[model samples]
Target: MNFEIPPGLTDLLQEFTVAVLRTRPSNLEAFAADYFNNLNEKKNGPLKLSGALRFQENDTVNIIEPSDGHGSSNEDDDDDSFVGPPSSYRDRRKSVSAERYDPEADDEGDYTKVVNPKSDEQRRRLNDAIKHILLFRSLDHEQMQEVLDAMFEKIVDPGEEIIAQGDDGDNFYLIDDGKYDIYVNIDGKRKLVGNYNNEGFFGELALMYNMPRAATIIAASRGTIWGLDRQTFRRIVLKTAFNKRKKYEKLIEGVPMLSSLDMYERMNVCDALSSQTFRDGQQIIAQGDKADCMYFVEEGNARVAMVNKADPTATVEKEISRVGPGGYFGELALVTNKPRAASVYSVGVTKLAVLDVHAFERLMGPCMDIMKRNIGHYESQLLHIFGDKANISDLR
Candidate 1:
C-alpha cells in the first residue's frame, strides 16, 4: 500500500527526529542504527495506513521473507519502540570545575570557565563605567574597548599600600570604588597629602616621565581599582597631552612680552615655568635674592615692598608699588640677572605666567636697552628735583 504524508506531518516528523537525536540514547550505536533504518523504511515502503509514516526520501521498497531479511518486522518493531538512555545523559554537560576535567563525567569541567564581562546588550553600561574611571576622555568606541580590555580590576584592603612613595613607578590606577589616602614624605614625616575617591586616578606623572612615585597611595577604606599598565597608559596620554600642551603654548605666545620670543626661547620658558606655582602670601621674588625669572600675573594681586635698610628700624617699611592682573614684575631680574631690590608676594591665590632670563634676553634684547635709557631719564629728573642732595642711582 502507498502512503501519503501531509506537508505539516513531514515537518513535524523532521522536528521529532532532531529532538530524539538530542534527547534519547542508551547506546548511541543502536540508536543511530534504528533511526537510520526507520528513516529508510519510511522513505522506501508504503504505509498500510495513510499519513502514519512521513517520507524524507524517494526509493522503492522490496519486501523480503523473514529468513532473507536482516530481522523480522516484529523484532524490528520491538527494538524501535525501545526508548534509549536516561534524560540526564542526553542533557548538555555543564562545567563543574575550572581547574581540571573528569573523563567519565558529563560535566564540561575546565573548558567552559572564563572571566565573564558585560555582554553585548550590557556593553553601554560597561562603557559608561569605564568612562568614569579613565583620566582623559575623547576616546572613540573601538579605542575605548581596547583600553577597557587591557584594564584589570583589583581590590585593596584598608591600610594596604596601593603604591609606595620613592618606588619606581610602573602601573597607573583608577579608583572604581571606595577611597584611598595619599601620603608623602614631608619634612621627614609621612604626611597625609590628599584623598582619592571613586573615579579618581593616580600614577599619571609616572606615565609622563619615568619618575619615582611622588607619594604613597594607601587604602583608607576597602577599595577597588582598575589598572592600566604603564605602556598602554603612556601611549594614550602622550598623544593627547602633547597636543594640549601645544595649544597652551600658542595661548602663551599671545601674551605681549612673550610674543617677541622665538620658538626655542618660548620652549625654554615653558619648561622653566612648568615647575612654578604660587600660593597665597608666598613671596615670589624676595628682596636681595638673585632673580632668574620675570613673572606676569595672570590672576590675583601682588605687593611690591621696598625696604630702606639705611633706617633699619624705621617705624613703617616702604611700599614701593602694587601689581594686579595683566601687570608683569621681576622684569629687572630677566634684564640684568641681578639680585631683586624689592619683594613681590601674592595678595591672594594667584596664577603667574613666567619667562626665564634667557628667554627674556632673546626676546626683549632691544626693549631692555630702551628701558635702560628711560631709567636714566627718570634718574636725571629726580636729581634735578632733589638738587644732588638725594641719591637716585639706586632707583633703577
Candidate 2:
C-alpha cells in the first residue's frame, strides 16, 4: 500500500521547527502542546495570551485559561519539567483566564441601543477620542455613528470597583476623565499590576473572547467613562468585519490577474487585505526599495513612474502609466521577491487596499505563473520608453 503526506502538514512542521529552534524550550512536549494550542485559538479568532506565558526564552509555562474544576489535579497541572519555581507556576495560572472565542458566534443577536444623553459638544469629543482606537478605526462612517450612539456615559466615584477579577465581563470601558488602577488577584490578595488614565480602555479581553475579566479595575478618582455593552459591541464590530470582507471579495473578483482564483481562494485573499489612504502626489512605492506589500487601487488613481537606473545622475522620473480603481500595482516585487521596479505616487486623494508579501505568497500561489508571464509585458513597455538605457533588470 502507498500513502502520501498531506500538503499542509509540511508547512506546519516547518513552522513548528522554526519556533522550537528560536525559543529553545527545555521541554519539547509542553512547548509543542502550547504552540499548537495557541495556533488553534488563532485560527478560530483573535486571542490575547497572558504576558506571563508568552513564548520568551526565559519563560516556558503554558498560558492559562479559566479551567473547569472537574478536571483531575494532574490533568490541570503544569508540566513538572517546566522551568521556574512551583510558586511561580501557581502565580502565573492565577492571572486572568483570558478565554478564546469566536466573535461571529453572536452575530445573530439583536443590537442593543443605549440612550444618547450627550450634547453636541460631548458627541464631537467622544467621536474624536474613539476614532483612532484600533478597534473602531476600520468602521465605516455610518457604523462609527452607531458606535457613538450605543456608548453611554458612566460616572464613578473615587475607589469604586469598575470591574472585578474572575467575573464575567459585560461592558468594554473607555476612560474619559480620571485615573483607574488595574489589579490582579494573586494568593487571595489584590496586587497592583498596572494603571490607566484618560483615553485608556479596558475590559475588551473579556468581551472579545467571552473570557472572565483578567484583572480588576478600580476608579482612582471621580472619573467619567464611556461604556458599550457586550451585545452592542459585538453587533457593531462583527458586522463591520463581515461587511468589509464582502466588499473586498467583490473588489478581488474584478481584478483581471485574480480572475482565475476560485471563490474560496478569492475570499482568502479578501481576508488578507488592509486599507490605506494617501494624499495627492504622496509616494506610495519608491523605486529601488525592497517590496514588503502590494497595493490595489480601491478609490482614485495612482501614477506609475520609472527613472533611468543605468545613469547615476538621472534623478527625474517619467510617468509610465496610471492605475485606477479595481487595478493593482506593486505586485511585480512580491512575485519576484525583489526591489520595486518603479515608483508609484498617488494621483489624487487615493484609497488603497494592501496585502503584505507573506500573505501574497501564501494566498497568491495559484496565480504565480500568470504574474510571471506578465512581467515580460511590463518590462517591454519600460523598454519602449527608456530605449534600453533603463537597465530594468537592475531596477527589479
Note the Cα lDDT for every prediction shown: 0.51, 0.67
Q: In model 2, where do residues sit more than 4 Å from their true spots?
A: 1-112, 246-272, 276-294, 298-303, 306-327, 330-351, 355-381, 391-396
Q: Write the per-residue lDDT of candidate 2 for residues 128-190, one digit (tens) a residue.
A: 888755456558788788888888999999999787666677787877888777655544555
RMSD of each: 34.0, 12.0
lDDT of 1 by residue, 20-93 (tens): 32334577456644644544453345333223232223532211100101111111111111122234323533
**Candidate 1 positional error at 10, Å:** 82
If scored against the real structure, what TM-score would every candidate get? 0.35, 0.57
After superposition, candidate 1 runs with Cα above 4 Å error? 1-254, 262-268, 310-315, 357-367, 370-392
